[model samples]
Target: MSEQEFTKSLTYAPGLPKDATFYSGHKKRVTSHAVSEAAENALKERGVAVEDIAEIVFDLQTPFMAGLTMEACVENVRGALAKRELQHAILVGIELDKLAEKKMLSEPLQSLVDQDEGLFGVDETIALGAVSSFGSIAATTFGYLDKVKPKIIGRLDQEKHGKVNTFLDDIVCSIAADASSRLAHRVRDQEERRLPKKR
Candidate 1:
């Protein structure tokens, strides 16, 4: 399959907001060759490709201190793809504000946010790594993944709080499955195009 052909069936779902601050991405972009190379490298390392990928889904059900869930999801998606060097990436973000309140990881998490003390709760670095991979486009509202779908998810647990993100993760997993299928078809098409032309 050829490159463009590989991307033919690559369809992306539009990102939607699960709540006020929670947002997600569902699209494919062909810009940035360097980013593409990075994705490709990452994919090679992971033994996957954008065209072969089904979807790149992530859920952010953590207690927000000063950032947006949308931003975090995008970053996680991007970081996952970049880590593998895949071609396409799809970012799915889910919200779980209720859980945050119930768990009470909010105020305490926020208190130590700026301290940089490195000892309070779960780990800010983990959260940052989870949300900054896809290149944040907005303060806490919008962002975009540098790659397309068919991306292999690198860190799932770190990306979303599975223990507390049940509902949100369920939806995200569904979204990821859809994206993965679409990406795989795209990859198949590209492979077909790569075949030599018969004269």
Candidate 2:
């Protein structure tokens, strides 16, 4: 077969002109709600409650966001976790940490993950990927949280408990950062809406 025909014969993602025939079906796709629930459960299983993450969000946003209640901070956390990309990051990052905890990963990777080496930046990379979607505010907030390691996040980073939280800490940073960004936008939108009423 010609090179073009050979390329067309391959069945991969997107599938171009062959998508209608190649990728069409009643495929079993996960629901957004289901993914959100799974992400929440994963956090809970790792002893990192959504409420704990919300506290971080509250800390990050409460100053700039007037009248932002803890309840609203928690709601924003759920909103951030509902995102599919963020959920994927949570699942993958947590799985890596879990593997390190159990020593399932091999050799240097296991050691690096367990120790959470200063130079091992993969954890931050995964987290930034999730937060970057929320814009620069969320991305910068993630960096700040990563640096500060406040509250529950700081506890997770402590190794005395024998829990490997290399990725979970950063994952928490991403969630809190994204939620704070969401809350910031929400508050700004509410203010903008009120302006019309005032006028």
Candidate 3:
């Protein structure tokens, strides 16, 4: 892709605090919502709608492979996991038929792409954050999950990243899943506070 094309692929998250800081290695904040929002904004800018995206799956059951296509990306990710010999898989779907059919989730996953929705749920947020941290692995994983189901299920293996310990992984997930929700609230709150009617 050209520079413009690449630039168009980036998405920016709204409402980043002016004093907010970014981590260096990304392992800590990889799962954060800010990263996810930025990535989604980038892809949308590139014309890839969040709704159009299939899934965001993470497989640490294998080693990471280089030069992967969308299909290969999953395998490569699995390879990355295998390399670490991690024994778990996490998948988050952005849009899935089953979720829409069961109506288990508050809104169809598509609502995530709707900026007007003002942040509703964690489905898209988590997936977006994981993708931001892990790149296409998260997106394709989500795509794969969407093809199968909507529930963000995975093989629980907390022991894998024990050496690099921190609740940051959990934090990242929370941030991604709820960042937009918080953003919408913050924006609305800011606006509300500024309103003469309320004052």
User: Could you give candidate 1's per-residue lDDT for residues 61-160 as a string of tens digits?
Assistant: 2232223244444443444444312233311111232244255446654334323233532332222333343333211211122112123332322243
Worst 10 residues of 2 by lDDT: 1-10
Where model 2 places Cα greater than 4 Å from the true spot, the runs are 1-28, 197-199
What lDDT tens digits, residue by residue, belong to model 3 across residues 102-194? 444464443432221334434444434544534453444444443343322221112232111111222223222222232233445767889
Residue 110 displacement in candidate 2 (angstroms): 1.0
Q: Which candidate number would show the highest TM-score if scored against the true structure?
A: 2
Expressed as tens digits, the lDDT of each residue in 96-173 for candidate 2 is: 998988999999999999999999999999999999889999988988999899999999888556689999999999
Q: Assess each prediction's global lDDT (C-alpha) against the native.
A: 0.33, 0.86, 0.32
- What's model 1's overall lDDT? 0.33
TM-score of each prediction: 0.24, 0.85, 0.21
